[model samples]
Target: MENDEMIIPELNNETIESMIYIIRGQKVILDFELAKIYGYETKRFNEQVKNNINKFPERYRFQLNKEELDIILRPKKSTLAKRILKNI
Candidate 1:
């Protein structure tokens, strides 16, 4: 094969499994990941969706509840009011 046509290494099953774990386990990704892949910051990504909330729908994105936020901010003891902050 030509240099440009050289075969690239394939991701094995284990690598695929690890990718799935990372996506689901990491509740959120940083701005860098969004910018690199989707050409936007996490805040921008959220705002665009928020502006078109009807298009996105609740099931697609919804704020975390008090209990859910508690788990997220675990050991910090967040106030009930703060915990109910709307997530975009």
Candidate 2:
């Protein structure tokens, strides 16, 4: 195989599985993790999502409330909130 044919080693089934979470009783992946998969920074990826918001319907995307966050996240609520705020 040519050097260009070599697979990128960082991507694996285990890593992909690790990024998925159950939120609001749905299996979902966060924007930052999706951004990494697509080789874009989180902010840039979110900007694209915002620009194309109409293309994504309600079933496709939604924000979490504090109650949903508590159920989905294992970390302390304050710690996760701080991390989320930093990403925003």
lDDT of 2 by residue, 3-77 (tens): 323233587888788767887678888776676577666688788899998987879788877777667566645
Clashing pairs for predicted structure model 1, backbone only: none
Q: How many angstroms is residue 40 displaced in model 1 relative to the true structure, after the best TM-score fit? A: 1.9
Q: What is candidate 2's local distance difference test score? A: 0.70
Query: Could you tell me how far off, in angstroms, the CA of residue 72 lies in candidate 1 after the best superposition?
Result: 3.4
* The 10-residue segment with the lowest total lDDT in model 2: 1-10
Which lDDT values do the candidates have, in the order given?
A: 0.43, 0.70
Give lDDT tens digits, candidate 1, residues 56-77: 7654444545665555445444
Candidate 2 total steric clashes: 0
| Lowest-sum lDDT 10-residue window in model 1 | 1-10
Q: Each model's TM-score, in the order given?
A: 0.37, 0.66
